[model samples]
Target: MDRQDAESAVRVLSGYPTEEEVAALIAVLAVVGQAARAAPGPEAAGARPGRIPAAAFAAGYQSPTSWQAS
Candidate 1:
């Protein structure tokens, strides 16, 4: 999607974010969408809770690490 399309979508979903913020959000969404599209289809077509595809990690997606006291 182009910048205008991304801005329009962000406007509809958000409350007046700065243009820079909208652009950043769009970039992030694009990366996530691309990763999702590249991932292989579900294995065996059965529900599996808490199972993230390995491709997502390879694409730089990370789960939240446990918080540690500094």
Candidate 2:
């Protein structure tokens, strides 16, 4: 959406936002949505019952094997 449209939506959704702040907030929201969608299923499940970590967080931080040189 354009600057004018985002600003109007922000006003209705929350309150009036300045031009610069509105633009930045829109960009931030986009990134947040992207990350949420890209997150792994278990990691995104949060504190729901019956869920447990399959691996330690430290062990989970692995480089993309597909990108490594053979």
Candidate 3:
């Protein structure tokens, strides 16, 4: 999603997220967005071996819980 879409979704969340939570969300979104934009399209199908789809990457993501872990 684009910046505006991200902003809209955050605005609609049930409860207000803490500043740190929002920052973390934004960071995750930024990484995913960059990956999605950089990902090869269907035209490059079968060109790479063991290529993981971006969706799968996002689905398997584990956010860091503390500064030390991060």
Candidate 4:
């Protein structure tokens, strides 16, 4: 690995910030990262409901509607 990458993961682009400020930022980032990983994700938002085809109805498939109501 490159010397810079191995030494540090953060870089200063502008004014120098105190060590406490960097520590706080890193803590917040770590909490948010953990929350995101534990989440059920976008796919778990809800059921992927879709309209039943006319042919399915002809074959006696029950329609779905009650769940769509807000």
* TM-scores of all candidate predictions against the true structure: 0.41, 0.38, 0.41, 0.40
After superposing candidate 2, which stretches have Cα over 4 Å from the reference?
Answer: 1-14, 42-70
Which 10-residue window of candidate 1 scores lowest in summed lDDT? 61-70
| Candidate 1 to native Cα RMSD, angstroms | 10.3
Give the Å shift of residue 21 in candidate 1: 0.4
The full ranking of all candidates by lDDT, starting with the best, is 1, 3, 2, 4
Q: Model 2 over residues 1-70: C-alpha lDDT tens digits?
A: 9998876677757876677777877899999999988877653666555644445435764445734853
For residues 4-49, could you state the per-residue lDDT of candidate 4 as single tens digits? 6433434433445557657866898999999999988644754344
**Residues 1-70, model 3: lDDT tens digits:** 9996676577748566667668878899999999998999665775356565676558975434544586
What's model 1's TM-score?
0.41
RMSD of 2: 11.1
Segments in model 1 whose C-alpha atoms lie over 4 Å from true places: 1-14, 43-70
On lDDT, the leading prediction is 1
Model 1 Cα shift for residue 36 (angstroms) = 0.2
The weakest ten consecutive residues by lDDT in model 4 span 6-15
Name the lDDT value of residue 43 in candidate 1. Answer: 57
